[model samples]
Target: MYRWLLLSYPRDYRRKRGAEILETVRDTAVTHRGTRVAANLVRHGLRARLGRPASRTVVLWATVFTLACGLFTASFGTWLTWLGSRPLDHDELAVAVNQLYPDKPVSHIDRDDPPSVFIIYGSPLSWSSASDLLLGDGGEYSLAGLGASFEQLPADSRPRVLAELLQRLRASGWDDTEAVYSNAYDCVPDDPRCDPATIPSNITVYAQRGDDILEVSINDDSTTPKMSLALTRSTPWSAYPVGVVAFVLGALSGWCLFGWASRRLEVRGPLAQGSAKFLFGFAMVMWWAPILLSTSLMLSHHLSEPHPRWHPLWEWLGQPAMSLAFLCGCLALGVAALSHRLPADQTLAHP
Candidate 1:
């Protein structure tokens, strides 16, 4: 067990001090000493992986880069897991709609049948659509789902319909949550001028069975649909663990790579080092800015509605949609790597 834990350290560090570390661990192998030593080994091993032990700035930047890598990795893992789950087919969606409202066939319908499970501009990710992803229709990227709208649903009958639907879904082996009621418009809850009784509240219910989710929304907003239904697949159970493991691995990789670049550049001349810094800055801005923007927007959207199952992590990070930005960041990193070799004569040997 102690030997296995030592693998966390860098290859050179392990070769030099592996025996000494194992000897110390065995010497302190009392009831709880082994556990404590194991934890310390992992912590320090990770710290050793990032070379500048004396510089606090290195640790801080390493942490930031690691976290960014982890987020993107987790999103990618979640997206892969999503691909394994089944999408709602046309027949399945039709049946669900019919079951919900047998008397009234849904008049207006919108289905999510994108070329790819994760889509940008109704198509698979490609460089040709860079314009759409960045400036045209990036916001359109979303997971596949089925949606229907009822523009003429009577307000008086909404309560009865919702009640019956809930009872029916429950009887049919579907698990459900209590309906959430909130104002359809932007009304300040604490404002005396905004009368609660005067404002119409929307009704929303969420139900689940297996990996599938159903959302029923009844709204009173004049511009919005009167009633809407959305059917989508929930994130698979395996995705959680996969995402977590991917995040940890990605963080380690990011830290190690950053440390290598930092240490290598320290011995180089001004031009190479300066180029690396500028390229890294541009890459970070490209990669991280879209994540921040998309995360905020997705959070607000979820808060505005009753989202039983949140959208995939990639969507929140502005994935395939902002894949162009991610690609640009990668190119910058590649250029930075090239810059390291430009001034071979100025490079000095360093430990």
Candidate 2:
């Protein structure tokens, strides 16, 4: 660990002093002096990286990195929000229907130039709850949603449509097996689309391929002929290798930016103690902790079925946590920058 971490130092410095540092670490192994060594290595590493970076370059890239972090965080947050709200059972059918025909009219509609929340086409059950979360100056034009409706179809065509859907799904890499019927899935409490009036008294068939899930229902709720189908795709983001990329980038860049700012403050006066500076710098990086906590909360919900009451805690903390962390780091930086003056008594000498 010590050796690897030491490699973070400037290449030339490491080349000259790497063996000496390692020998010293071995000599002081029982006392465990490696922490101090690693800390100095990083301090020197920063100096090396900064190797006379112009003020303009520093300010410009700092802004770029900060903006990049914000963009990434926003994107990741949107993705997480969308991922969290993905339709599971009956809701999926509703969303799929809405997307299939968004131009269809509905009631109780809320509209926005780029909407955050709106109900799509249908009577009571068809009005899908949709949010154009991606709309704004830099808005996302796409939507992830669910909607449902009872369409007239002959009883004879029911088997044919289902069989055709099954064949297509199988051809598209879905499992050949179909899900067993369950009366227990009668009505979902949160879904207004599952109002118990539109769904049939007959059996429902569910099929799946990875994250893609398809459901077909035979509803005799209406006096006339009608069939119910709901399709949903719920992606558990944190599980996939690509899914966590945003979270990882958010946390890492946040740490690095905070670290860089705090280091600048530390090196202002006399040669700051390497250990103290590192601790302070690292502590500043923990501002991203709130984001991590929120992410964990979301992941827990995705990974498990339990809806613990404490789940709201995660939502509540999501932004506040990041805010608090950023606030604390800024407060520290402000104080340090304000108090720190140019070094006149001592200078940081080569270790």
Candidate 3:
């Protein structure tokens, strides 16, 4: 076990002192001591990679990663804005009255603050004495393809409208819809969180027709029932901005650590800043490289042939490929750095 752990260090470090390290581990065979040694080994190994010369491939991939990340982040907001601005599929309300809405007049409200149900938009408390209000769950509409109708409707009326919608959806012709009940549809049937069994308060129905899918969830406890209509074609582009933000923050953190390691080496010893920085950056961002590279490859492969179902396989390989590339990169750079550095501070190199 310690032999494998020592292998985590740069090959040069191991070559010079592998036997001595092994002897130390044998002498101090305590489990906690072994864990501490493993941690130090990893730290020193990764740090050592930062003082080496990088190859052309390393520099090329690093530049690609940085530019691709920068471009994706820069354009992510625009993508989200475009997605938000997409024109909703507005069919004749007259035709949809029996299918989606009640036979009541839809109240006019602000475009940003639309109604939850087919009828009026008001708080349940505002008119609690009169009628049951239907409150629209603003986000559920985005998923169900309801566009944002429920936002303005009275909360008490929500259950009534939701139940009506569900009944109509179930009665509609579903032969064509069943053939295309895909994961792309709204309120995904396979979504574990949205499972009807989990939400004991809600009576749920999922019905698909043509490009439209309706998810009616009437919570027995809450006056408002969640109803959503979804378009299968409307992909989840809304998630782009969020993913871009997370990717940027993670990449930035890794880049900073790499820079710090390289800078420290430059100040303390004879380290090649140019190559070390190149390799370190490459290793740091290679986690996203598979995703970036595979997307194009998959697209091209799809266009050339017809691989609609191979996407999951490629996605599965992305993380593992990233980890392997990063590890190999670190080891390669570590070997190069140790060989190139002057012998003046060999002691410093050990740490």
Candidate 4:
């Protein structure tokens, strides 16, 4: 059960701190009732989600939670729409390319432009492999003999390492004439195009294989364009399971808080009821605010080419909002506690 509770933490965080947190929980459980232990577990779970100190006042926490909800709703809706519109696989790229180059023969394509002009076309997975070929230690583009992975070389060939190296250069951007016909291996100190130093730090590769015929362009800045592999597109069903779980957990939390509030008011009198209501409200806010803010930040960072300055403000607002929400909640709880201490008639009059 305790291990299950720890699952609420991020994976990296759990790996680093799970043992210590579990130990603390166990000690707390030994000193308190199981119900209290559960409550603490939940409280800590929420604090972790909020990315804030658990000791924060209630009003601040509530405000943060509300803001977070707003951010999350906006961001998630935007992401779902964007993802829906994006190409799912390489087939989409092939279709787009065919439409662009209708007159060109599909085979024996050639271009005289600099080696920097080749386009790379592949799936995301293949693109990752291609990147390793180009940028990994001893990659074709790397300084000679450095960062080499000899395992990448194919079997049954003399000068196998050299052949593998030349193949990468050809795939990267070297023209067929330059790669196969010319003495590409010959070191030329001053030849304008052939000079090793003249070669751009990055190269582009255009692929027209399988279903996709798109270009994977690389730049000196180390950013590579998205690559596509021609494969059947599959729906993102995995995300659906996660979304369902989140919806269920959110619903359960809301329900539990509502029930707790109802009991406090009916059985514990006005003060206790009010306090419980406030605390519950505050807890709800704290629980959701960080989640919403983080979602918004992540979406904005990944999907939109928005200005950098805007991101910090979004992240910054989260902290104060959480603090204010928690503070308000604590005030309400205090008011409820005071009401419980007073006479029933006084409680009724104040309420």
Name the top lDDT candidate: 1
> Which segments of candidate 1 are over 4 A away from where they belong?
17-32, 108-116, 124-128, 149-152, 180-202, 219-226, 292-305, 320-325, 342-351
Which candidate, 1 or 3, would have the higher lDDT against the true structure? 1
Task: Report how far residue 22 has shifted in candidate 4, in Å.
Answer: 48
Residue 216's lDDT in candidate 2: 52
Deviating ranges (above 4 Å) for candidate 2: 1-5, 9-19, 22-206, 210-212, 215-227, 230-239, 243-255, 267-351
- TM-score for each of the candidates: 0.78, 0.35, 0.29, 0.25
TM-score of 4: 0.25
Q: Candidate 4 on 40-59: residue-level lDDT in tens?
A: 77666544543424334543
**Each candidate's clash count:** 0, 13, 25, 41
Write the residue-wise lDDT of candidate 1 on 153-219 in tens digits: 6667778768887987787667888898878777777999888788888888898878778888888
Q: Report how far residue 23 has shifted in candidate 4, in Å.
A: 54
* RMSD (Å) per prediction: 5.1, 13.2, 19.2, 21.7
Give a tens-digit lDDT track for model 3, residues 1-351: 777876545566679988987887677666557678777765555444444454334334434445444444434443344345434344522244334555544432123322322122233123442222212222111221343223233445645655555455656563212111112223557777676544434334445444343443443334433433333222334445655674576444444344334435655443465566566566545545655676777667656532212332223224222435545555755653554434574454464
What's model 1's TM-score?
Answer: 0.78
lDDT of each: 0.79, 0.47, 0.44, 0.41
- Give the backbone clash total of model 4: 41
